[model samples]
Target: MSSEIRQLEPKQLWNKFADLNAVPRPSKKEERVIKFMKDFGVGLGLETIEDEVGNVIIKKPATLGMEDRKTIVMQSHLDMVHQKNNDTVFDFDTQGIDMYVDGDWVRANGTTLGADNGLGVATIMAILECTDIVHPAIEALFTIDEETGMTGAMGLKGGLLNGEILLNLDTEEDDEIGVGCAGGIDVTAIRSYDQEETPESKIGYKIVVKGLQGGHSGMQIHEGLGNANKIMNRLLFDGFENFGLRISEIDGGSLRNAVPRESNAIVAIDAIQEEAFILEINDLANDIKTEYKTMEPDMVIEVSETETPDQIMDLGVQEGLTRAIYAALNGVYRMSADIPNLVETSNNIARVIVKDGHVKIGCLTRSSVETSKWDLANMLRATFELTGCEVEFGGDYPGWKPNMDSDILKVMVPLYKNLNNGETPHVAACHAGLECGILGTNYPEMDMISFGPNIKGAHSPDERAQISSAQKYWTYVLEILKNIPKK
Candidate 1:
């Protein structure tokens, strides 16, 4: 563990976070971390149970004289989105996150720090181990595979938990309590293509776009960051029209929930036109850089020579694929009429891939309104269908509706203001998906609210957690627990 993290305030929470940094818990591959969590609970002599889908539930009895209080469930996901810089060599399946403190924040080396829910999990661990804190009966729920899909939350059976109140420790901002979140569904389009041999007179060049600050698709969608997949399509469309470029392969982005940061493509052009094509690409790159100068100053665009491939995508397939992607909606489409500055509906053109016989495009759409969610899905389906591509939707999860009169919110909001010296925490709804939605379906009577320490750039390699905010959040949650209403 790094000495910087070791020296952070609230030794218990930071220490547990350090321990998590030594475990690899990427989404859908959490066996090692699961064992670690189960053992940690057992070592503490708490009642621990692992559900069929791998959600861990650890129960601790209430403090003396507090046994009559309503049970509170503290929930956070056990998995993290494993994203890394292209130059980084770490493997998510075998390697632990290499984290270190960066001034006032803790970050990883060229990879995601997993602080999104790790900090929450660690805080729960700290609370379970501490004998000094006063709290009612606690049930710590560690869910799995939240990054890719809400598999754990979806599979969670009703009546599995007895808690009447659930505190979801997954929201990023320390100063905001998330009362609700947008539901989401993934859209995928695929089109089979026939390959044609590259013309003998053509030379191959690789075009790449990098250095964009790709972030959480939902949380950062309104930030105006560039999406690499969208940018790549623009460049490809231009090259196709001007230079007669024939694409051999194209790939970009990785996760459906993260904004794409980098993209690249290999294309063939007549050797005589190569010089002009290169110059045009450079000019286009500069134009893009200028357009996004404020949000992505470090954005890089490069076109370089590469080995010629034997075959390229058929002209018709190439044209259709490029056009479809270029026309796809890729950012905020609508903002809430009721909530100021809140995005009510949005789309992320998350990923694109070209393989042996087909090209596939992946997209994710989110909306707080059920009607808008399906509206956006149908729009995406129509866009792809026009290009003769087959489209499908999956991983749909319902949104959590806000309850201003929520029982837990009534207690926590006032408690937060008191703890923060009269500064009230912002109670808002998120555009991103949270497990609270699915959990609520199983436990309709359970009152829930989501909040956490300040974490930035979630679902991307730039993710980090604020050190001071972690300490402050820990103190706030403890006070809330101490004041839980008696049943």
Candidate 2:
């Protein structure tokens, strides 16, 4: 099936994508990909260095007369978020992504296509391995663990790269030139609870919240797609209120970055209210579906009877857990006053698990403004603390502040216009977390910009990349490389 992906036009880029995806490069688990990259750089006989924290840097001298141009950094993370559908059986650790050609797009079979950064990685790899492309000195940077925490970027030391400008090929929309991006922090809440013996009168059932269109929590946070954890909590809250339902175990969502798509809970309820519970839940599910019909047309909320559990969460803890999740924020918090149609601050209640006398809740908060980032974080911390959960904040990274006066922007804007029937590209900041910000700390003077092909449903199983857009973007990359400013 991956052979189909290799056949896409611009074989240089698609072939590299297929090769990269053939290796398992999940975040925080990139040993194989790291080796692959090192071998690639060495194979080309270029100056290659694998930093202490696992970032690979491959440098190539300027080709032909382009030596007069400024050196540039081409960066994309080597890692991809590992996500799959509930009904799909795939091992992200051992097997390569099974991809197929779908109309004008390329997609994985029931799994994330890894186009977010893989496409970017492929683009750079194509150029690095090329013999005819006219470009300035290239510094190919491949970072690890970008999907989960960005630890690779944080751990990178200074004085390593000689480039004066950076061209980040990680932006999703081909028509947009990204000048800025949001920073993020991880919010985790944990606590202990006592499980009580299930009442003799209680019977068990399974509640599944699926079919929601989950996506990149940051890029699509403003789209109003449903969050599975929030939807599941709503169902549990209503059931407990009406039927004195007791929770035995609940597991919702997967990664903290991808908006949750599926959630399932095991619960026990008083048998006397079984008939009423089914009717009430079905009606509520229908109401929820109606509320999101346009955004999540395929959303399905179902409850089915299941084997009984031996224990249920303490009534007090159960009540607190539901209330805290209900109170927590899960979508866009503020729009940028500085930029039109930009999400300035937001939160994704990304994951939730309540089981075995323990509770864990994970969230990712993003904001371009430093103060606003913590403001929303404290909001989540306070909300969960109300439920006696000790919350911790980690993986803090800074946002990329937009430079309207950027020299690279000036070069890219007019070039993009000439490339597209004189149509101007959208010059703006995005809500998604890009490594441009983190990479800037050590090289403050480096002018940076990001752009890429159109990738939809990123961070979710429905992820796909456009074939035509990739060709268009490929042309842009070639032109940009030829036009790097003189040193």
Candidate 3:
């Protein structure tokens, strides 16, 4: 290998990470990254197959002594969730992620680090390139659009893989091995009413809610992060009680799975009470910030001056929309009564927007149990119906059921324990969705286990990967590959 190849020891993973980050590979826009991998595979003379949907599977022949060992498929998603702050100007489609080093941590500049799956991608790249590592016949399966739709995994066929055992390299924690994950469904509610002309004397002020730390709805839902959309609605609800205000426009939040960071409402306030309204709004924001100081320290409301704004929605529509959002779910709804630390059912009021004469609210509901998920979905439907709004639901995916008796776990438990000096790995199920559950339904008999290095702030601009954990996970993965027994 040339010096430019960048050796991928955990300490040196940053270099390889830098190389990958230099390429733009947002979800469904991975032609360059796909071609890069293909070229690398061809250069190494490895048997590589690039599927129609940009999913790539590279086959590496087993070492001389381990040729008889069984094959194990190493799986990871190719694409990443593209998100950035409102003030960040970088474009995901054209710009490569700008990354920087922070001691043992590597993070992107004002954008998601892509370390959630980038580490997995780089690990496979190094594994296939290394000549010294011991391994059986290995298949590095890189699927596409996992963050948004999981389209690549959904297109998989039964016989596509030659391996009966799969090792998913997408888990976030280094010390824990994920055995299962919650399933999710995306639901949208839309309310539309005729616009009304602004009253001649009604004053218009832009009520803005800003500076909240919106995070991944799944991972950070339990963390008590403030949803800006929910906060904005609260202000509107309170303002209506004091002074009659017409909601001209209401918009906030982003990503179906991320807590809304900012919200803005353009409302028509009574001109006589405008000064008091501004003071009250600021006071309310301050009080909310103090209340959620630990969760959202920077939370604030800015009542701004604006030119004569066009009408957004009529009073009746505004009232119905406000009521619907108030009744809508925002935080932890139900906890697992059975499991000690499990979140059985929950929903995030992820995104709310006013566009094209419609008020659209995007909600994400998750649960380990199918019944609970459906119940939450039904609740959302009922809420929309109460407002006489049309509701739509789709993008449902299955949850991975934990297999305490998973066949692969039975074999690998002792191996992992022995490798780590008898310190057993933590076994747990995640609240977030994993490909394992979807793949489980696709391949009923396939045995799967997920493990990865420590990654923080996944699905957010502040995401970073721990350097030392990468080395540990790489070494452990190699051990598993070398010890795969014959089927």
TM-score of candidate 2 to 2 decimals: 0.99
Residues 256-356, model 3: lDDT tens digits: 77778888888888788889888887888778888899978877788887754567576677788888899998777788776667787889898888754
Residue 443 alpha-carbon offset, candidate 1, angstroms? 0.6
Residue ranges of candidate 1 with Cα displaced over 4 Å: none
Q: Put down candidate 2 lDDT per residue, 1-487, tens digits, no spaces.
A: 8778788889999999999999998898899999999999999999999999999999999999998999999999999998998899999999899999989999999999999899999999999999999999999999999999998888888899889999998999999999999999999999999999998899999999999889999999999999999999999999999988889989999998999999999999989999999999999999999999999999999899999999999999999999999999999999999899999999999999988999999999999998999999999999999889999999999999999999889999999999999999999999999998998998899999999999999999999999999999999999999998999
Off by over 4 Å in 2: none
lDDT of each: 0.92, 0.94, 0.81
1-487 per-residue lDDT for model 1 (tens digits):
4567878889999889888878989988999989999999999999999999999999999999899999999999999998899899999998888888888888999999999889999999999999999999999999999989999999999988999999999999999999999999999998899999898999999999999889999999988989999999999999989999999998999899999999989889999998899899889988989999999988999889999988899998888888889888999989999888999999999999986878899999999998999998999999999988999999999999999998888998888888889998999999999999989898999999999999999988899999899889999888989888889
lDDT of 1 at 78: 92
Clashes of 1: 0
Clashing residue pairs in candidate 1, if any? none
